[model samples]
Target: MRLLVMLTCLLAGCLAEKPHPCESPPLLTGALTVSTQNEKLWTYTRFMYDALGQRIRLMELGTYENKSFSHDVLALFREATMYEISYHNRTCKKKPLKTDFQPLAIPKDATLLGQAVLGSSSGPGQGLLVNTWTGDLPGKAGKYMNTVTEFGCIPIATSYQTSEFGWAVTSFFNNVIGIEDPGLLNPPDFCPDAEMMDSKVEPIDFLSLFHGKA
Candidate 1:
């Protein structure tokens, strides 16, 4: 009985540490559009990056009922910092970012779903299904997972799910054409709290925006 218990313990440890399939790190940097099933515009995010996989800029653009909204964040890895600016449609509350900076990396619990053709970009990319812990999926205790699709080692799409709503690709973007917009990496003069840069931003409401349209 003791031997049996020891063997079971060893097997459980092995399963707990499942080996990840060999995959190149994602170099996602460019404009990405995320939406729902009915082609409703959820988020239009533009990204810029340096030689490393560091995200330099993340610009989110959206239009709801004939109203346009824009919010963005600037990431300065070398400075170990990032700045978030919110274009409050309802209120102009420019809350500062509060999370500390850490090097970007893939989720450790992510499992490779497989390779498939995605978007108009050439070449095949792998999908990472991450088991995330957010109070979104029903009975999931806020712990749910989603698949992240990447192209050419760059993330092109993913479906974000939450318990407040059903599973869907809340945010994703295609046609990630390269650009040289230096100004995008800089916070505007109106954003006086650049020194208080951090790594947090407001979450986009993907389902609420697509009310009747979906």
Candidate 2:
């Protein structure tokens, strides 16, 4: 387990995201949309948020199916965190959830976006390669966890495997570490969720890495 986590840390930068100010404050008190069938596209969803703007309650209406016999679904996931204050937070806490399909789309240019993966440690903990992620996936227990991006794959935490997110010590941002086959390229739109920045496209602020603080 010790060596495995170390490997994930090494690959952290490739899949990690750098913290930037949100375009606008989160609509904490808003409706969240979800699809019914596959998580890749149009997830079925129809649920209500609690008074505290937390997803404490749920009501599952069937997917917008061909108006056939409708069914009710319940929310199994919980809203742990909303926004972030700084890179001090965020790290991968969620365990690996395996899927059979390999990620279809891999970024040609991996240096275009954020630098840290899920659950990346704060800048202080980051070595020459580490980065701070913020306002992203709310890890379990409201804590941050290093995340695995589409291009970068998630590593399995086996006692026998190598350390870090599964790359050589020199693999930061060069080539992917754990990802085997890049998954879907043109995935079905999964509602209005925050789209993970595609690794192929560069953000205008890409140069901010060398610029003064925002």
Candidate 3:
């Protein structure tokens, strides 16, 4: 009888579910390395994200077509506008930003794939716990797998595929909790004289902009 009771307790413990982590914070600053299969491109980017203000800014340095290029992009989702600026040439382009804002949180419908610790776990608090989730993008646009910290829900890595842009993997690092400089979200001074591009085109995949497609 004692053996049966012990077995039942162990089983219950094994079956217990872990608590869900909180969604990502509204404001964040981070650096991410992005690689795209179709473009055979690699980009190092530092980003400032302000979910409350519906804005994001990216400073990207990358190699494309066997040459180095750098740009800064300011995306204003609320205004449906994007500004791409090249400080090297003192040029800027203002175009329609058709992509909607996607929060950092895992979707409600995401399937939990697995969980693991990211570093040594020989002692208490020795490593970071993370969860992996997979899901189809809305409207069947693509598929994505994300790994995020279990406690803070901060993204650690993401791999996704889209029909238009193919596959891309982004690894996040040096993430800070809040935006330190609100001015980072502002377009450069040259943006005021930016060329105004036509707005009659179809919506583009947001990632494509990084590939120099925009």
Best by lDDT: 3
> How many clashes (backbone atoms < 3 Å, residues ≥3 apart in a chain or on different chains) does model 3 have?
0
Q: Quick one: how many clashes does candidate 1 have?
A: 10
Stronger candidate by lDDT (2 vs 3): 3
TM-score (C-alpha) between model 1 and the true structure: 0.46
C-alpha local distance difference test of each model: 0.45, 0.24, 0.83
- Please write out the lDDT profile of model 2 over residues 1-60, one tens digit for every residue: 999999999899677665432211111112233322222212222222222221211222
Q: Write down the TM-score of every candidate.
A: 0.46, 0.18, 0.85
- Candidate 2 segments whose C-alpha is farther than 4 A from its true place: 1-29, 36-44, 50-55, 64-214
**For residues 133-195, what per-residue lDDT tens digits would candidate 1 score against the true structure?**
122333444433333334233343345555444444534345343545656565566565434
Candidate maximizing TM-score? 3
* Model 2 worst lDDT run, 10 consecutive residues: 205-214
Clashing pairs in 1: 32-173, 33-172, 33-173, 34-171, 34-172, 134-142, 135-142, 136-162, 136-163, 137-163
**Candidate 1, residue 177: how far the Cα is off, in Å:** 9.4
Give residue 184's error in model 2 in angstroms: 38
RMSD (CA, angstroms), candidate 3 = 3.2
The candidate 1 region of ten consecutive residues with least summed lDDT is 205-214
